[model samples]
Target: MTIRFGLLAFPGVQQLDLTAPYEVFASMDDAEVHLVWKDTSPIVSATKLALQPTTTFAECPPLDVICVPGGVGVNTLLEDADVLSFVRKQAAQARFVTSVCTGSLVLGAAGLLKGKKATTHWNALDFLENFGAVATPGRVVRDGNLFTAGGVTAGIDFGLTIVAALRGREEAEAIQLSLEYAPEPPFHSGLPEKASVEVLGRTRQRLAGSRMARQAIIARLAAARHGAE
Candidate 1:
């Protein structure tokens, strides 16, 4: 039997978040991976890689897994009715609903993470509470069938974990071995708390504009929700 996977593809997505997991899944037996977008056009990644959608939202199959990857583009998707509707519809039937990095924000926006323990990039963890999700700090978090990866590189770990659940530990191990998925970075700056004050400041400064934009969007959404109730 074939296990189908569909990941949301949009403009300005973090390429590694989508591709790293994709490579893991594609290594498995009888895996069907489809990049689903509004259309079949090539979308530019945040890092400028051009990726073509394999299927349209209208043409996506009954996927066993639905993955959403995060990037600067995620802020725009927070309130996109069509995108949220698509995710909610897919989640209704998908065996595993997952996201990478800030993509959890999209899942929360789709009303899928209510009261669930979830995690995103460290910088955005606090925002999870806005959606009634318990903000967790971990490399990868799984609440039932909902799996969310933390930050960027965690996507590889997230993918292997899901594959192990679906296939087997041996299969995941074999795939990991094939891909040489070992990690031991020379730097200890992966987490904000561990980073030097100078590193943190520079990184935050680089991400200032996007962070500000996301905060504004979150605040606006919160106010709108409050007014509606």
Candidate 2:
């Protein structure tokens, strides 16, 4: 049986968030992976890498898995009716609804994460509560059919987890072996808890601008929702 997977490809997306999973999904036998967008036009990533969409929201076939990968672009999607609608519509039928990094925020905005245990990038983890989700911490968190990953590099682990769930541990391990998925960072400071105070401060300072922008957007969304209620 063919497993169809769709990953949202949007402007300013973090390329690794999409591609890491794409590589894993593509390596599976009888698995079809798509880069989906509102249109087939080329979109650029946050790092300025160019990506072409294989299908549009309207043109894409029913997918077994629908994944959203996050980056600076996600703040815009939080308020984008079209994008939220597309995700909501797809999540209604997809076997697995998933996201990488702050993409979980998009799923939350679409009302899929309410009361569900989910996780996103550490910087954005606290924001999940605004969507009525229990903010869980992990490289990947799975609550029933919803799968979410942490920041950028965690997508690889998330993808392999999905593969194991769908195929088997052996197949997932084989894929991991093929990809040589091993972690060996020179610095042991991937997480806030692990980083030195100086390093963490610098990192947070660099991210403060985007973090503040996201906070404003979330606040606006919350106000709009409350007004609607």
Candidate 3:
């Protein structure tokens, strides 16, 4: 059977977060991939890469796997009812509801990860608690049909993991080999714990604006939920 995969395409999405998994899934046998957004217009990725949507929300076919990718754009989506509605609708039937990086934040906003183990970009990991999700530290985390991954590069891992879940580990490994997916970064500072004070501080400073915005969004969402309850 052909596996239909839909990855969210939105403005300001981290290209790697979407494209890494996209490349991996596109390599799989009988995998049909779609870049879906609210419209067919072109959207700029986080790095200013121009990407066009292959399908619109109103016209998208039901997918077996639906992936939401993270970036600065996700903050805007946190309050977007249309996008959240689309996600909730797709996730209701998709065999796998997945996300990478802060994309898990979107899933949380859609109410899909409550009480589930999930992970996101390190900077936003703690924010998962606002959605009633158990924040996980794993690069890739799966809770039932919900699969979440860490920062940008982890989307590749997320893709392979999903492929393994649907196909097999051997097939996933084959695809990995085909793509030469081996990683040997020169820095041990990938994790916050290992990062030098200088590196960590610099990154924190850079992300402070977005992080603060996201925290405010989380707080607002939490307050709304509490009020509704």
Clashing pairs in 1: none
Q: What is the TM-score of each candidate against the true structure?
A: 0.98, 0.99, 0.99
Please provide, for model 3 over 1-229, each residue's C-alpha lDDT reduced to its tens digit, 9 standing for 90 to 100: 9999999999999999999999999999999999999999999998999999999999999999999999999999999999999999999999999999999999999999889999999999999988889999988999999999999999999999999999999999999999998899988999899999999999999999999999999899989988999
Candidate 2 clashing pairs, residues 3+ apart or interchain: none
Q: For residues 105-163, what per-residue lDDT tens digits would candidate 2 score against the true structure? A: 99999999999999999999999999999999999999999999999999999999999
Model 3 CA deviation exceeding 4 Å by range: none
Q: Over 4 Å off in model 1, which ranges?
A: none
| Residues 98-143 of candidate 1: C-alpha lDDT, one tens digit per residue | 9999999999999999999999998899999998899999999999
lDDT of 3: 0.96
Per-residue lDDT, model 3, residue 50, is 99
What CA root-mean-square deviation does each model show from the true structure? 0.8, 0.6, 0.7
